[model samples]
Every structure is written in structure tokens, then in C-alpha cells.
Target: MKTILFLLRKEFLQIFRNRVIVAMIFVMPIIQLLILANAANYEVRNLKLQVIDQDHSSWSRQLVGHFTASPYFNLTGMVASAKKGITAIEADEADLVLHIPSGFERALRREGTASVHLNINAINGVKAGLASSYAQTIILDLHQEIMPVVELPAGLSSTFRYWYNPDMDYYTFMVPGILVLLVTLVGMFLSGLNIVKEKEIGTIEQINVSPIRKHQFIIGKLLPFWIIAQVELALGLTVGWLVFDIPIVGSLGVVFAFSSIYLLVVLGIGLLVSTFTDTQQQAMFISWFFLVIFILMSGLFTPIESMPGWAQQITRLNPVTYFVDVVRLVLLKGSSWWDIRSQWIALSIFAVVINGAAVLNYRKTD
Candidate 1:
């Protein structure tokens, strides 16, 4: 225990002595949090719209007014024909084109039905889908306002109440996940590079020839990063609350408790990487390869449920996936310790297995 404490002291001294690492540890995360929280948004807004109105009727003009008034759309131009609207789309000047054929009002009044055509740029499928849905909702609202209503038999009506995030602010959904990412990057990259840096500088040779046991050395290397990562998580959460107004709906203790174990999984992976690699460059490349795969498969940007079956199955193997889910659940949903029990157990097993492998792989005699 005394030996481990001495090694921990040495590790912290080394970390603080490096000015570049100090800046990376404290400054870079705040900058990234500020930038990425605002930039990585999924909401589509301010779509350019072109209109083709052949009827020149009041109803057609009203439809155009609805589209222009919406926050999601900008009125780029009003063309006289469908050909002109199509030309605007082809020129990248319009995202959607509304074509109201001639005699639209006449058809509605005479036959109680009318048709309007929508031409949308479908190059970005997700953006196009959102734009289409927003436009359709506006048209339907106009239809409901204009058409006469008749009393009918009572039926079921559904009302939605969005829990946790009532305003549907994208920041609320994104900040917690981003916090996980930052913590993971710090813990994984720094710890992974620690041994490799020592090896490069000829310091690891001295440690290998010391009286320190393998478990003592591994714990010494792992604990400093584990503690630093927790501090980073706290800093991120504070920034998230102060800057973005993100709420902490659960206990801070619960968050740190899970984080303590999760950092082990991350730091273990780092140590495991260092065990196989000889140089810092090799360690970085290998670490980044695993980080990218883990993060992309972690459901940070997309929903796990929406992924294909095989891809979803792969997420089960990702430690980041479980941490991301657990953090969001605890912070956003106010989930209890029992609520995250399964994840806790899984991470515990990972912590043991990964660190065990890293210890077994580290050469004490060489």
C-alpha cells in the first residue's frame, strides 16, 4: 500500500510537470464542450423554399403565407411555373418547392378536394424527411382551419407529455452524452500514453527493475488517471449546468459512483493498449482506433434501437455504450442505483477482466 502511494505521487508529479498535458487536461475539454454542444445538433432549420402558384387564387396565396411564416422555412422566391421552381431546385437555390396547380380553389369548392404537389431535395435523407414533416404539419393545420367541422362520435384522443426534456432542447439531450465522451477520451488516451511515454524516455526500464510488484505498479498507474477523469466529469457537468442550463435530476453521488467504475473500464483499456505497444505513436494510433469504434457504436449521435440488428448486437460489447446509457439515465431520468444495477454489474466484470489482462501482459522482468 505504501509503495502504491509513492508511485501515485510520482505519477501525479509527472503529469503536472508536462505543460502540454496540463493544458490538454484542463483547457481543451471546456473548449470542446462549448463548441460541440452547440454544433452537433440534429434539428433542421431555415430551409429555403420556392413556390409555384398557377392559380393566383386567395387559397393558394394563403398556403404560401403559411409556408413563409414558419420558422423552419425561408421564402426564397415565388416562381410563375413548375419549370422555374424545378430550375431553382436544380441550382441549389431551394430545398423544397410548393406547386399549386391551376384551378386549385375551383376544385376544392366544386368537389370538396384539391391537390398540391411538393418537390423536395432528397440528397440528405434525414434533413429532407424533417423538412417534409414540418411542411406537411403546416398544410394540415391550414386545412383544419379552413374546412367546416361536423360533430362525430366520441373517439380516443392522445396527448403527449415529454418527460425530462419538456422543451425538446437538443442541448439537454446532447450535453450528458458529450460529457461521457470527454471523460472517456481523457481517461483512455492519457493512461494509454503514460507507459508508452515512460518507455520512450527510458524511465520504464528503471520501474521494471524496481522492487514494485505488478499489481502495485498497475494500480499506481491506473489510480491517478481514474481520479483525474472523475474530476473532468465533474467539471463538464458544472459547465453543462452553468452554460447550457442542463439539469441534474439525480444524485451526484450516484453519478460519481458509476463513473468511478466506468473509468476503470476505460483506463483498463488504455493500460491494455500500452502493454502491447512500444512507442507513443503506436499507442496513440491503436488507442484512437478503439476509441472511434467504441464511440461510433456507443449511440452517441444515433439511437441504438434504430440501428440494424447486427450493429445493435455489436454495441453490447462496447463499454462506452453502457456508460453513455447509464449517465443519461441517472442524470436525465433520475434513475436510481437499482435502475442501473445491470450496467453496474457489466462494467464491474469488464473492469476486472480488462485490468487483469493488462497486468498479465505487462513485463515485470524485461
Candidate 2:
């Protein structure tokens, strides 16, 4: 215990002794948080809308007015024909085109129905889907206002209520996920890089020559980083709350508890990487490859349910997946500890196996 304490003291000294690393530890993440929280938005706003009105009727004009007044769309241009609207879409000038055929009002009044063609640039499927939905809602609202007695088919009209984040603010959803990522970056990269940096500076050889046990050395290295990562998490959460008005709906203690366990999994992986690699560059590239895969598969931006079945199966092996999911569930939805029992069990097993492998693989003699 005394030996571990001494080593911990040494590691902390080494970390604080480097001014550049200290700055990077705090400054870089803050910058990334501020930028990414705003930039990584999924909501489709300010969509470019074009209208081709062949019929200069009041009904057609009213429908176009509904779209223009909508906050989701920006009416860019009004063309005379469908061909011109199609040309605008091809030129990347329009995201959606509303085409009203000639005698549209006449057909609606006489036949009680008229078809309007909607052409959307499906380059990005999410954006197209959202734009289509927004446009359809406006059209429906207009139809109800203009034609009162004309009732649509049953089961077609339904209302939805957004829970937790009713405003659908992207920042609220993204901040917690980004906080998880920041903690991960600090824990995995710094811990792996620290060991490799010691190798580069010939300090590791001196430490290996000493009468320190492997467990003592590993504990010493991981403890300081573990503490640092927790501090980083706290700082990030504070910034998110104060700056972005993000609330901690669930138990903050639960959040810290989960993070503490998750840190061991990542730190152990870092140590495992350090055990095999001789140089910092090799460690960096190897860690980077895995981190990228972990982030992409972690469902940070996309829904896990939307992914292919095989791909979703692969995410079960990723520790980040569990952290990202649990953080969002607990923070946003106020999920209880019992609700995350499966994640806790999976992470615990992951920690034991990963750290145990790292310890077994570590060689003091080599």
C-alpha cells in the first residue's frame, strides 16, 4: 500500500510537471465541447423550398403562403413550371419543390381531390424526410382551415408529445454524449500515451529496474488518470449545465459511479495497448483506430435500432456503447439504477476481463 502511494505521488508529479499536457487536458476539451455541441445538430432547419405554381389560383397561393410562413422552410424562388423547379433541384438551389398542376383548384372544388407533386432532393435521407414531414403538416393544417367539412380517412390524424426534451434542443441531447466522449479521450489516450512517453524518455526502464510489483505499478499509473478523468467529467457537466442550461434530472452520484467503472475499462485497454507497443506513435495510431470505431459504433449520432442487425451485434463488444446509452438514459430520462442493471453487469464483466488481460500481458522483465 505504501509503495502504491509512493508511485501514485510520482505519477501525479509527472503529470503536473508537464505544462503543455495540463493545458491540453483542460483547454482542448472545452473548445471541442463548445464547438461540437452547436455543430453536431440533427434538426433540419432553414430548408430551401421552391414552388412551381402552374395555376395562379387563390388556393395554390394560400398553400404556398403556409410554407413561406413556416419556420422550417426558406422560400427561395417561385418558378412557373415543373421543369424549372427540377432544374433548380439539380443545380443544388432547392431542397424541396412544390408542383401544382394547372386547374388544381378546379379539380379540388369539382372532384373534391387534387394531387400535388412533391419533389425532394434525397441526397441526405434524414433532411429529406424531415422537410417532407414539415411540408405535409403545413399542407394538412391549410386543408383543415380551407375545407372544414372534408374529413380525412380514419387513423391518419394523430398527435405526438415529445417527452424529456420537449423543445428538441440538439444541445441537450449532444452535451451528455460529448461529456462521455471527453472523459473517454482523456482516460484512454492519456493513460496509453503516458506509459509510451516514459519509454521514450528512458524513465520506464528505471521504474522496471526497481523492486515494484506489477499490480502496484499498474495501480499507480491508473489511479492518477482515473482521478483526473473524473475531474474532467465534473468540469464538463458544470459547463454544460451553466452554459447550455442542461439539467441533471437523475442522480449525479449514479452518473459518477457509472463513470468510475467505465474509466477502468478504458484505462485497462490503454494499459494493454501500452504493454505491447514500444513507441508513442504506434500506441497513438492503434488507440486512434479503436477509438474511431468505438465512437462510430457507439450510436453517438445515429440510432442503434436503425443499424443492421450484424452491426448492432458488434456494438455489444464496445464499452463506449454502454456508457453513451446509460448516460443519455439516466441524464435525460431520469432512469433509476435498476433500469441500467444490464449495462452495469456488462460493463463489470468487461472491466474484469479487459483489466485482467492487461495485467497478465504486462511484462516487467521484458
Candidate 3:
């Protein structure tokens, strides 16, 4: 017990003694949250909206004016032909195009229907979705006001209320996800390379020749990094709250429980990487490469639904996806254990699979 505690203490001090590293552990995630929050917004603010007004009437002008007035869009171009509007939207000069047909006002007056063709790039699906909906709402509002002489039932008019983060601030959504990245990164890199350092220094052979069982030795070695990563998790989250005003809307105990289990798999993965690598540099590079791909594709910066079907299917096999999703659920959505049962189950399965692989690969013999 004393030896275990002493080793843990030594490891903790080694990690925290470096000022640059300590700051990076706490600061990088916050920086990423800020950058991603800015870039990850689904709202198309300052949207370059091009217009093709064929009607040349008050109603058509007013329609274009409505889009210009709305904060969600900016009128960047006014084209005489629909082809020019298409070129604008296609050439990256505009994000969306609004075309009022030649008979727009006339059709509305006589036929009760007028066509407005809105062409949008759905590559970034969320922004496209929001842009379309905002345009639709403006058009619908104008329609209701102009033609109030006729009325429809309740279904045609609906109001949406965002349950949490009503402002749709991406920072609030990204803080927790970045927290997962920070913790996972610290645990994997430190634990993966620490053993390599020991081996490089000829200390690993000294310990192996002793009576220490592989499991006990491995667990003792990992315990410090594991605890330190958890501490970093707490500190990172606290900073996120104070700096970014992110809220913890769910149980801390639940978050910790899930995090603890998830860390097992992460640590196991690190140890597994260390087992295959010859040096600390190799371990670090491999672990970092693995982490980058896993985090990027894990729905941390974007929604899983927005990914291609094959990409989404591939992400399902990545454990970080579950970790990020569960943490976000707890933080943003106040999801309880029952609400997160599927995540818990998937993480449990992941833990079993990874730990099993690590144990199989971990050997005392050369």
C-alpha cells in the first residue's frame, strides 16, 4: 500500500511539476471549445444570401428586404437572372439563393400560390437546415399577414423552444465534449509512454525480475495517471463553467461513475499502445494519431446524423463517441442513468473488449 501510494505520488508530481504541461492540460480544451464553438454554430449568421427578383414588384422587393433585415442572413448579391444567383451560391460568394419567379406576386393574387426557389448547400447540414427553416418562417409569416382573410388550423403554425441553451450557444455544447478529449488525451499519452520511459531507463527490467505480478504492477503503474486524469477532468470542467459559463445540469456522481469506467478502457488502450511501441516518442505519436481521428469523428465538433452513413456506422465502434455523447447528455440534457442506459451499456462493452485485448497483449516474458 505504501509503495503504491508512493508511486502514485511520484507520478502525480512528475506530471504537475511541468508548468507548461499543466497549463496545457487545463488550457487547450478551453481554447478548443472557444474555437469550435465559434466554428461549429449551425446558425448561418452573416449568411451571404443572393437574390433573383424577377417580379420587380413591391411584394418581391419586400420579400428580399425581409431576408436582408433578418440577423440570420445578409444580402450579398442581387442578380437579374437566376443563373447568376446559382453561380454566386456555387462559387462560395453566397451560401443560399432566393429566386422570386416572374409571376410571384401575380400568382399569389390570382392562383393563391407563388413559387420561391431556395437553393442551399447542404454539405454542412445544420447550417443548411437552419437557413431553410428561417427562410420558411419569414415567408410563412408574410403569407399569414398578407392573406389573413383566410385562416388555417393550428398545425400550420408551430413554435419551437430549445429546452437547454435557448441561445444555441455552441460553447455550452462543446465544453463537455472537449473535457472528454482532455481527459482521454492525458490518460492515454501519459500512461502509454511512462512505461516506455521506464523500459528505456533499464528500470522496467529491475521491476519485472522482482516478485511483482503483471496485473498488480500494471494496475499500480496506471493508478496514478488514472487519478491525475480524473483530477484534470474536474479542473477542466470547472474552468469551462467559470470561463464559458457552462452549466452542470446533471448529477456529478453519475458523470464520475461513467467517466471512471470509460477511463478504464482508455487507459487499457494506452497500455496496449505502449506494449507495441519501442520508445516514448513512438508511443506518443501513435496515441496522438489514434486520439485525433477518434475525437474528430466522434461527433464532438459535429452531429453524428450529419455524417455520411458509412462514417456514422464507423463512429459507432469508437468508444470516445459514447463518452462524448454521454457526457454531453449529462451536462446539456440532464440525462439520468435510465436516460443513458444505452451509452452505459455500450461503454461497458467497450471496456470489456479493450481491457481484454490489453491483458492478452501484456506479457511478462520477452
**Cα lDDT of model 3 by residue, 1-366, tens digit:** 665666667677877797876776667756765676566655568878999888998889888888889998988878889788878877988889998999888787776777799999778887898889999988887787667543333345576898777877777887788878878887888788888888788888887788767777777778877787788788877877888898889887788889888888889889989888879989989898988889889998778998999999989888899989888888888989889888888888887888788777777778
Misplaced by over 4 Å in model 2 are 149-155
Return whichever of 2 and 3 wins on TM-score.
Answer: 2
Q: Which ten residues in a row have the lowest lDDT in candidate 1?
A: 149-158
Lowest summed lDDT window (length 10), candidate 2: 148-157
As for candidate 1, its clashing pairs are none
Query: 2 or 3, which is superior by lDDT?
Result: 2
How well does candidate 1 score on lDDT at residue 227? 90
Error of 1 at 106 (Å): 3.5
**Residue pairs in collision within model 2:** none
Query: Model 1 over residues 116-204: C-alpha lDDT tens digits?
Result: 99999999999999999999888876676667632222245455789988888999999999999999999999999998898899988
Candidate 3: worst-modelled 10 consecutive residues by lDDT: 148-157
The list of candidate 1 runs beyond 4 A from truth reads 149-159
The lDDT, on a scale of 0 to 1, for candidate 2 is 0.90
Error of 3 at 197 (Å): 2.1
Residue 324's lDDT within candidate 1 is 87
Which RMSD does model 1 reach against the true structure? 2.0
The TM-score leader among the candidates is 2
Candidate 3 segments exceeding 4 Å error: 87-92, 121-130, 149-159, 305-316
